[model samples]
Target: MFKAYRFVFIAIIACFALTQCTSVPKRTQTPQERPDVQQQTLDLEDAKSSADWLEEAWQAPNDIAKNSALVQAALTLQDEKEWQKSAAILARLDKNQLTNDANRYFRLAKGRWYAHNQQWPQVYKTLEGLPEQFTQKEYKRLTLELLAFAAGERHQYWQALAWQVEAQRYSDEPSPNALWQTASQVTQSQLPAERPRDLVLAGWWRLIDNHHQAMTSPSAFSALLDNWQNSFPNHPARERVNSWVSSDSQSNEVDKSTNTIIAVLLPLSGQYEAQGLAVRDGIIAKVSETKSYELVFIDTHQLSFEEQQSKLEELKPAGVIGPLLKGSVTEWVRQTSLNTPQVFLNQIDADTSEATANSHSIFFALNPETEAEQASEFMSSASSRTKRPLVLAANTPGSQRMVERYKESWSGINEPSVSLFSQRDDMKSAVEASLGLVGSKERIRAVKIAAGKIIVDEQERSRRDISGIYLPGNLQQVRLLKPFIDVSISPFAERIPVYGTSSAHELTNQLGDNDLNGLIFSETPWLVQNGGQNVLLNQWLDARSGWELSQARLAAMGYDSVDLLQRLPIMQRMPGTHWKGLSGVLSVENQVVNRQLQWAAFKNGSITVLEEQPNAGKNNR
Candidate 1:
């Protein structure tokens, strides 16, 4: 059943895979050994603008002078925080051509440029090796600050805290609030068993541990804060402990008592009735065991504006949820007082919210962007050498939006190669073109014409630089896409990792999903499980022959929505609080719920849930 080309390619690739990559290292040279430009001092104040400096650099008489002018221009741009422009100018100047002072300054500018691009690893790589003594006081300060920021962004919490403390030598005292936020995402296991040698960092570790233990109880948390203040008297966070207590005390203001009445608003009688019903069922299922709260469903589509307003006034519920349509959500916010804490089921843009703007409500849209964002993060954090990836999406509005979101979240320097296929017949060609196999074939044809024989030494190949392939397509498209991708890859090339979005997965027979083998995709935990509520839901759906993956996902969202109403207050107060809901690991920040979904892969025509790994990005291989 295997193709002859695959067998031939496998034999060739196996040999190549065993061959280790070798690099020719270049000898390092110091600035003093390269250039003697001490006599030619450059004055940055002489230039009015970066453009003036760039023009001056272009007209300089010597390489040293030209490099000096370029450094000044880059510095000017850095001071202005124009990172992209500064990076472009820095790219033009050779480091070897500059004096020691200019070279040191160039390193700082380059570090800032990498930081601006959100390339945290590159930022550390560029700046971590720099000398202790910088050319200017502000330069040293900025370097430390950038290192701290880069470390924090990379989730190197301890390093970030250390760098921040170091930066305080030149700047104001390091921000305890910033450090607290940095530690929010870190778990207890991440904390060292042995206390950090640095007293300041140790105090921070203790504070995080105490906060995590007592977060569920305001009284316990208040007592712990007092204890933390007494124990760490000279700690930077000691002053902020009282404010945290105040914040925790304020959280108690949100009513947490049982038997509270909550109103639900959803479209139950219109075009989107099915979606509304599924979500409603999920909510109902989640709350069935709990008798503390009363649910009141308001059909937004069935009621007129006046009728809905009157109904809400009569019910006077503790909190409201729904208005699933984007337009309805916008309209509801604009028209109502929104005094009651509400959770809208959809997201609205700033332009849409300008008229109806209310900050009290939370938006919990099942956005495709969330899946795309997580996928991007997964690929960026993965150990694969693929800096350049091919992103394949269908010629559809949803797929286009997802592709755009993925691009926005991508961390690499090179933009992903995107291939949009409109027709089923064109999918193979699109994949081949994106992976540069077409060019490989063209080269093979050229070789055959010149040699006047089929050359055994030369082989058709996929681009070696492609680290991976990301297919953000629907179930059918992804099924087709995986095979095309498998065939397009060259035998001499390393096996490229393939990733997909939730749309690529469905509950189907193992044989039906054979094409999806080796494809890793993101999906809700509810669909991947075999027991508990999933089992019950499966049995019920199977009895009625009404199981649909998309509807089940909607149901999971509804279930999480109900759970979130109770957890939202706790999450808002505790920054990194996470609730394990069927939809995902739900967390909230700035009134928006974020879902960290589970990753699953097809193995031998069956789906297997990937165990979450530490910094491993899901055992992607």
Candidate 2:
């Protein structure tokens, strides 16, 4: 489990140890300015609250004592759950005054603060190097745990499992369950194809991977555990596997039903009928791959709200997935008695506090904002040295949402320059204005006007301040926007990076996508798998030549919805666990399922999946 840093204990050790260190140079403070060292050491023992430590820092004899006191004050604030207050104190501390050990404590405190705020990149930057640096086992253990949690949060499951394996050496008891949880989340593709160098980690990974296949068949899990223990008799996990099997058996005995009925509601014959069918088709596709389920589909458009309620009462399904329309979903959830582990296709307008509190239902929507936030996260961690960004969006609700989300998630100091175009005709003009092309043209015109007959050899120049451009538009819009951006960049300026949403990419002929070359975008793994060499997806596309990418995405949503139905309970119980779904890497927070999508870029007029970059923003900071 992830726990807050017990800085109070470490802070006290760091405080007293500060006076004995001779590694750092002594501060050149006047003799009159310094407090009595013997008195200050005695006063430090009585310091308890943040204010008491701050008072001690103010009265400290020199820079070393002062920094130690300040560091303790910050740690004290963090231990009290006042992270922001602690951050303010940490910001002002002079690390130069502290010994190597004291500086390690300072870095740990800052990393803990960043972890509390869910700032993963900052956490990675602050603590990625401190694991081996710590002399104390407790501090090193916490650092490894933080790194593991951060890696898992970012969907770096293989890295997370490695951290878990390392953390085990410091713990008194083995955390086989925790290691298994992180291991199970690692997709087959993500796991190293060959055995890893670490035999312990490799053995555990192989065991858990086999365990996944065994879980499908009744009584197979126990047999698999026995076989694994026999094979890796001296493995670290061998000791913990027995208890795990016993715990699983006791739980399985209480609830062993496999034939649970699930109710699905979609619009079969209305304005949104096509969208509803795509989702249903996706569900059927997944069901076809797995065990046969009694999937009862209800067309919300055809049935009245009260009739839908009466039907649910009579059927009493184990779970429900649907009511695709926003209005229908909102009305459906208002009925308190109809609660049965539900997954609404559209988000409810009314507050879902009551429904999600008890883990009865979750709202899953394929919103443009979610993809935009993912784009923002990807760009933030991208290897680009872009400090300033320019966001060019269409003047639509979805486009606006993208812009808003990009700005909200952005980590840089400079605010993104956002420009919106309402019409297709304005796309070129909007891109030009945002890039300062219009201003460049005006400047040349003014120079010509000023010098009547003189020949001006000056070329138009775009702004140099924009390090990157984020454009979240549809295929056609992106096609036009990319070309506009390509041509608009000043000859004098460096090639600025451009990022877009999944909507920006669609199944199009390579010749038609020449303009999108070098443009990076966020997309679902299902559509962009195997460098767009998705055999089944291509076959489906060839079979249905007229299907739009939006329909395909809805189908993906349907497929992942079926997955969510199976995994939501586990996610609800264990908040930070992730499932690699067809749509994206899914994790639940506040009963809302969020997707961390895969990334791709256009190169030589073809889509290519981008490799996941580790420590992406290490140098950027």
Best by TM-score: 1
Q: Write the residue-wise lDDT of candidate 2 on 590-610 in tens digits.
A: 688888888888888778888
TM-score for all models, in order of appearance: 0.70, 0.67
For model 1, how does the per-residue alpha-carbon lDDT over 1-621 read when each residue is reduced to its tens digit? 135434433543353334324222222212111111111122334445776776666566666766777787777766665545565566556788789877887887777666655556777988995638675545666777778777766667666766766665665445666666666655554666777778887887787777556544423756777788888899877767767668656745755652277888888988988888888888888778676678899898899877887888877676778878898877776788856667788877654345234545677888888898888777766634445767998889988999999888876545688889888999988988988878988887787788885555566687877766788887888878888889888876677889888787665632225677778788888877641236666764675365577777888888888767765544655555677788898776666778899887777767777896323222342
lDDT of model 1, residue 456: 51
Please list all clashing residue pairs in model 2, or write none if there are none: none
Worst 10 residues of 2 by lDDT: 33-42
lDDT of 1 at 487: 84
Which lDDT values do the candidates have, in the order given?
0.70, 0.73
- How close to the true structure is residue 130 of candidate 1, measured as C-alpha lDDT? 69
Any residue pairs clashing in model 1, and if so which?
259-292, 386-467
- Cα deviation of 394 in candidate 2 (Å)? 2.3
Error (Å) of candidate 2 at residue 58 is: 11
Candidate 1 segments exceeding 4 Å error: 1-147, 162-207, 214-259, 351-360, 383-387, 453-459, 509-512, 530-534, 543-545, 612-621
